[model samples]
Target chain A: MAALDVAPAARRGRPGYDQNSMLEVIVEVFVDRGYDASSLDTIAKRLGLSKSAVYHHFTSKAEMLEIALERVLGELERVFDDAEALDLPAVERIRRIISEAVLVACARQQYLVLLLRLHGNSDVELNAMARRRELTARLSRIFEAARAEGGARDDIDPALAARLTFGLVNSLVEWYRPDGPDEPAALADTVLAFVRSGMLAADGRGPR
Target chain B: MAALDVAPAARRGRPGYDQNSMLEVIVEVFVDRGYDASSLDTIAKRLGLSKSAVYHHFTSKAEMLEIALERVLGELERVFDDAEALDLPAVERIRRIISEAVLVACARQQYLVLLLRLHGNSDVELNAMARRRELTARLSRIFEAARAEGGARDDIDPALAARLTFGLVNSLVEWYRPDGPDEPAALADTVLAFVRSGMLAADGRGPR
Candidate 1:
């Protein structure tokens, strides 16, 4: 999760923005201008740094993209690993994983957004996408396990259920503002509640 | 919905692709290449037609974008109008709207995908975003009404609930395939059921 912070000492030689801060600006630029359309010059201009200064942190735009993607993908992989190690039931693990993912997404919103927008146009993008597919498949297997344990509903397909559930989580990237009124904890609670029993009142009638 | 089909008779003077078909290829190109990056030449090359042949349907790329957006926006507006006309409770109307949106999205996947990707970079995009915001506000009001009438859980903010619900629907554009095993009817049912009662077994435990 602190992959960017791991090399604060490496910034001693570089003046102005450090590696973490530089990557943050670079990612913002990438998100605003499509990655394919964004060049090193565009990123350098946005950062108000010389091209060499930008190059001081990352060798190429593709490297920046790869590092940014790894930050999010690595965090997500950790979530899955931790969830799998738990002694709890598959249903509980699913809930915990989703709750943790909400926190990760909110904390690393820009990285996650960049990761989500990628369409595998390059080798770095393709690698990120492959990792993403593996994570998705892992979640689907958890859903399958939950259904098998009779904890989750059996009627819906597990793969479809996993997609819808995480899709709801991923949609937060579209509107979630870190400085907004809803704290990550409260937002996570709301998501969990909706995923648990939905928007209808507890006493409301069932689906027709 | 058939905005592109309105001028088919005008195609008699043109050769190769007709207005509707040309616009379809243009949209596909726009989706593949970001709208801002795509030009008339790029669109024509994708369609295997000359630039003037491409121009036979529309005067400019913006015009094509406007027409394409209107197709999805117009269909959505019709859904809202029809839902408002129903003599049901606010909660039921919300259900119908989400259900119908899934169908519209499934039928016009590319247009909806394009609409969802738009970031309001231009006048046409801004107009589409404005219309989209109005639709979201309308849905939020319905959620508010449902809450006031005790049909929906009041704990979650109505606006947040509206965004999350529709966000789930919108995410369908990311992964849904028309020729996939799940039919639109079945998809709609799954979505509605998930929105209504969520993914837990009927007799399952509540949220922690």
Candidate 2:
């Protein structure tokens, strides 16, 4: 997330409270309670902000969703901007994307959790869904290119491969506890290991 | 699911309305609308069952959740009950479980979707959580034994391995459309192929 240096002029209700921090609390409620059931009153109560104060920042629950999704999409889009993306072999770039996704998800846990559960209930959600589909399509092209370059197998349909790959990546939202024993780096390596080599020992190398 | 032959005297309101099929419709609502938002009235309206008729079959939404979970948990448990689960090599058993899980998940799509999203909101959900944990522990033991026998790699922590393995299997709930191109059989083969061999072609052998 960007630094929380909102100019004082943009501040909403209280001098101490910032819009970003209020958004953080709101997203947390959205995560704990499904978005539809979450109300401005509930969000304001959680943050100790008055409902009118919340309105000072975001006009409606839908607006809050729009603002929160913008931040989440921004964080995710940075995956494609990694320096290695342009210079590496397509397969290598794909690996970098997978590895970085785990890190990004860990860093932006709450936002990503909300992103995954989205059902496209509103215009904002539909746009988020389109962005997600676009990202998946981008990965599919990379997978297809990797196959053409003879860097990957073609046994699985490239489209299906893209979907399953995202499935494994997004499943992080389901069970990744920040307090867990495995850190993002180690977990990424393990995921890469399973993706690069079958769970069985490397061919002809005896099991450890 | 229990046998369809409920004693005639035990039949709820309409002779035509049955528990298993009604449970199917109810579970779908739970999947579409998160469980808390799903009402007995909504379920009854879907089935054309009067509210009291729903009560005849289920005392409350919690009871409906309990009954539905029983079928889902039963379907999953039967995987471990497979003769192969006991007789095959531990790693083979693990592989068989992964393969069968996809089939069971596809067979019981609505129920499994509900099962995956379970949040332990009620005693029923808590029981489902316990059953799911038991399944995960069983798989971890299988993974540990499979590693000891040199049928699998030990590089990944066994418990982490169990979680990720289940994540991949359970992810089918997110995207496995019944109308999709791949049958459960084909998708199982694809999953097994990825699990047994990473999407990248073999390390040494020439590409097919």
Per-model RMSD to reference: 6.1, 6.6
Best by TM-score: 1
lDDT of 2 by residue, B1-208 (tens): 9979765674445457667878888888888776766777888888776789888877688887888878878978888778243767777888788899989888888888777776555677888989998988888888888889877777876777788777777777777889977799888887877777677755465211
What does the TM-score come to for chain B in model 2?
Answer: 0.86
lDDT of 2 at B122: 66
Model 1 per-residue lDDT tens digits across residues A94-115: 8898898888888888889888
- The CAPRI-style docking tier of model 2 reads acceptable
lDDT of 2 by residue, A53-137 (tens): 8788777888888888887677667786662347777788888888877777766677887777776557788899899888788
lDDT of 1 by residue, B132-196 (tens): 98999999999999999887888889999999999889988778898888898899999987887
What value does the lDDT take at residue A44 in candidate 2? 85
- TM-score per model over all chains: 0.89, 0.85
Give the 10-residue window scoring lowest on summed lDDT in candidate 1 chain A: A1-10
Best by lDDT: 1
Candidate 1 at residue A49, lDDT? 76
